[model samples]
Target: MKTRNQKGLESKYWLLIIVAACILCMAATFFAGVKSGPVRVIADYTVVPMQKGINVIGTWVNGVADNFVTLKSVQKENKTLKEQNANLKMENNQLQQKAVELERFYDLYKMDQNTSDYPKVGARVIANDGSNWFTSFTIDKGSADGIREDMNVLSGNGLVGIVTKVNAHSSTVRSIIDEVNISSMIMTTFDQCIVSGDLKLINNGVVKFEQLANNENEVAVGEQIVTSNISSKYLQGLLIGYVSEVNVDSNNLTRSGYIIPAVDFKKLQEVLVITTTKQDLIDNGNQTQSDSSEK
Candidate 1:
């Protein structure tokens, strides 16, 4: 709406301000100090404040860049540490398993030496009765390997159980701690005793035994107990366990006690099966007696 003269005046004013700003920028390269009054005032409000704003923006940008780099480095380090921790745990578990395996093998060797009179076959336990302790289990070897029902099973320096069922490919064993009859004898006195399993008391790592003659009092705590020669199914002289407790019955003629089983049922893995049964020995003895009578 203004006339040409008015518009021309306004253009001249803007051109002057631009020229002054350019002159001030060029002067900054050569002069470090401003001594003039008008120039100082203009720089204080305009150029100086603009420089301060630019400095603030640059400092903020630099801080943001540094913080981003630090965050990335921290995340990478955490990931690496977590991976290393997982690997160490896996290695430790493997080492522990190897140690357990070695211990089991050594125990088996000692047991074999103790019962060197019998021919034996080795078998690996395949499955258990779903309890913490292996009260009953199946093995990988069976009829194909000469395994049969009533074959005595051994592990961890003593008797484990007897085979109750046999298949061509696998067999089932009922541990002494299972609900089965066990005929045992004291090694020192050869006194006969009856043994059986109680599921409730087996949690304490022991089984029930009775009919030890109270008159003898010969069976003391810690006495070695083994399968009796008169057992109908299991072979004789296979170590069963050690006596843990003994008490005379109310009738006063018999004593009953608990036996701490030698095998760690919770950790059983491999076992030895005696190929001979008590019935085989009994038949052999009968044959020898008959031959002697004829002679």
Candidate 2:
């Protein structure tokens, strides 16, 4: 039996001997004029196939490298497109927000023009109870900005509420639809009545009014109801709502009905605070009356 090192050495010697034989054969064919024999057959069968295999492997390697480059480029382009799409979505959202803000401002402008006769201040509603409606909410303005308790708050072409609580920089308004508020109002026909704010009635999109002086009165549905001239806290003639349904009570002593509020409490956002209280109007009226009598 041969050792491992002796076997490896014999294998190396045999490989060298084969290489030397092939070289000698090529030399004989080229320079010694030995053509068209076993040497020619050896080159055709062995050397030609070896060269072809090397060329095929080189081509395959080049093709794989090119495919890898193309794949990387496609991935880069896809990533760039994703980034562009995200940025476009962000821009579209910003534009939509701006448009909504612009429309709100335009509506505020219209409200301001409608009540231009009074000394008023514009205020934004900032906070509210976690309900779906603005039943009672806080405004951004307060006593520091001349906001006072009982100051009338208006929105969307009609009266919304009155400031009930005031802080240094914020105030809470109690909407006319708030359950605690009982508004004194007058109809276009000069009939006086009391408006009640009920939670159940608000869900039906109207407030309750009862104690109509005349059940036989010609006040019909769709009659416009405004703040009465006699209301102490709420200024007179500010639109409250329109009459929706009228019915006689069981006692038949009075008539009760519903008024669809002019201001949509659910969509209430901004308001115009008539800075002057109802007391101010009364004072000015009395002062004028006194002056006229003296004259």
Candidate 3:
């Protein structure tokens, strides 16, 4: 009986301790709830560090959003610049082509203006043989176009030279300024002269003119000279050059002068070939005479 009574007493004491602990837990929870209106407390810690962490996280997210927006804007700008660059390149190419076409048209106009008298066939110079003493150039037209040897070759400005050789599709022209070319001439005043191409004289941009006939009037400076009617090679009245200086031989009637050629040989580009046959010349002359008689 005594033992049973002792056990009952111990059980009752344990139940009371549990009840006390439950009450203390409820009191603590009530106090914590009341203080959580503006400041929360768990055990002995406050919520300040958690609030700071939330603020830092929000700022980082906003920064990431701004960076993404900047990157997209840069990509858009890059695409636009690329398109503009391509357009500019296309425009530049078109302008260059236009410039080339204009230059070709100018050359054609010049060629037309220079060959108004003769029925001319225009040809472009394809090659130049400047290394040889007998300097020559090859043209794009030949015998099929009625281009023959010894025919006159004139440039857009004035007389260039004469055709020296002809092929089926091309011809070579030997310029009057070539070392082998010699032309007989007469001064506008009163003297007959012969002009020869000396390489040294051409180096100085002049030709040597030697007077042939005896005359009282010496060849004067600044006198114009033309191809003589007696010349077997060239047509009459074609301008050779003006006399720059006249040097008379001692105890001789003959004199020599320097000739500045009418044509600028350095810039020669396009040339016209006069292919009218010699028989045509005779026919034309006879026709003119008949017409005159009728009149």
Clashes of each: 0, 0, 0
lDDT tens digits, residue span 1-295, model 3: 9999999999999999999977866655455556454334652243345446778999999999999999999999999999999999999999998896567557556755644565678898888886533358899999899888777777644466788899999999988877654556655554567878666777787888885565766566667777665666665555667778877677577777787876666656666787763345667889999999999
TM-score of each: 0.78, 0.76, 0.57
* Residue 196 CA displacement from its true place in model 2, Å: 1.4
The Cα local distance difference test for each model comes to 0.87, 0.84, 0.72
Cα lDDT tens digits for candidate 1, 163-275: 99999989999988888778888999988999887787889888888988877446778999988988888788888889999999999998998999888888888999998
Query: In model 2, which regions exceed 4 Å deviation?
Result: 1-63, 180-190, 213-223, 250-254
Clashing pairs in 2: none
**Candidate 2's C-alpha lDDT?**
0.84
Write the residue-wise lDDT of candidate 2 on 176-288 in tens digits.
88875454555657788888888788898999898886545677788988888778788778888889998887887878898998888898788889999989889999999
Name model 1 segments beyond 4 Å from true: 1-23, 33-60, 130-133, 283-295
Q: Candidate 3 overall Cα lDDT vs. reference?
A: 0.72
* Residue 149 accuracy (lDDT) in model 3: 78
